[model samples]
Target: MNILVMMKVTFSTEEEITIEQGEIVQEGISLILNPYDEYALEQAVQVKEVYGGEVTVLSVGPKRYEDTLRTALAMGADRMVLIDDPALMGDEWIVSQAISAFAKKERFDLIFGGQMSIDYASAQMGPRVAVELGIPIVTTILEFTMDGQCAVVHRDMDGYMEKLRVPLPALFTTQQGLNEPRYPTLQNRMRARKKPIVYYIGEDLDFSHEDRQVKTVSQEFFVAPRRSEGKILHGSLADQVKELCDFLRFAIQ
Candidate 1:
């Protein structure tokens, strides 16, 4: 089996984040693998362990994203690929395009990814890639098992659950209840640093920045306004209602 895991590098919320000049400042910011993506990687590694196959982790991001790829390698992905193309970095759709291009380059029997990245939480990349490849996709999968060339999947639907039997060469976006992610061991870390990561740029993939422009643009970045303390009214029921009405009228005025 040839399995592919789509992963992402995200800023660690443990560290303070600051916006400057209409952009997020990278300085003093800590980066790590997206937590949800880690679950996908763990499931891929588990599949490779049970079945005889190679697992490859891939990402579309800047050069610094290699760090997160290395971390994935340490977690048990057999190989890593990074598309460090600044021009191609636009929106979730552009990233999905680049990933679809890479998928076309290499044939994969199964593709796994997180339901959404922590940064954007759009949850569109996996579905977009599946559409571009014309393959079936199942999102928010909680459990997955292989039988021959087909997959037995269990996923959450709103508050209920659904089971499916999807064929091979399909994409799946993992949810939190899928599985627990394992930490890299000391030995794995040593070997991961020595692993070579395949790198590519936008031109190599025949992707033009102008054609891959982001449809949604961020106008500005500002913290959510702080919430004010709640006001309490104490008196007889009628008196409390009258006081609330008075307060509302005064505020509206």
Candidate 2:
């Protein structure tokens, strides 16, 4: 089995985040592997351990993302690939295209990734990549088991569990109940430092100028405005009801 895990670096949720001029301030924020992606990486490593194969971690981000890839290496991935290029940076569509192009360069029996990154929470990358690769995909999977050349997975459908049997060369996006991610041991951490990361730029892949263009024309981020304090209605029940009615009428107007 050759497992491929799609990973991402994201701002740590524990860190204090602030928006300035409609953008996130990233001067001194902590960056780590996307929390949801950890489960996907752990599951891939465990699959490699049981099936006697190699786990490769892949990501498309800036150079600072190398740290997150090294962390995945320490977690038991055999190889790392980073698609780093300023021109390739865009919306999820462009990132998925880059990842799919990389996936085409290698053969993988299974692909694992988080259901969504914590920051954007768009939950579109994995599925988009799957579509680009023309492969079957199971999203928000809670359980996965291999049988012969197929995989049986359990996914959460609202409050119910839906079981599915998918063939090999499929992609899976993991949900929280998948498994606990293990921390890298000191020995593995040391070994990870020695592992080399393979990098790819826009020129390395076949992309036209149109493909490199940003699909999204504009994006804005702003902190939500503070909510006004609630008003208290005093006096008798009828008085309170009258005040509430008046307030509602005024608000509607």
Model 1 Cα shift for residue 74 (angstroms): 0.7
- The total number of steric clashes, by the backbone 3 Å criterion, in model 1 comes to 0
Clashes in each model (backbone N, CA, C under 3 Å)? Answer: 0, 0
Q: Candidate 1: deviation at residue 170, Å?
A: 0.3
lDDT of 2 by residue, 31-99 (tens): 999988999999999888898899999988888888767999998899998989987777888888888
lDDT top scorer: 2
Over 1-253, each residue of candidate 1 has an lDDT whose tens digit, in order, gives 8999999888997876678887878766888998989999999999999997999998988887776679899999999999888866778878888999889889999999999998889999899999999999999999999998999999988888899999989999998989999989989999999999999887777776565787777788766677999999998999999999999999999
Note the Cα lDDT for every prediction shown.
Answer: 0.89, 0.90
Give the candidate number with the greatest TM-score.
1
By summed lDDT, which 10 consecutive residues of candidate 2 come out lowest?
210-219
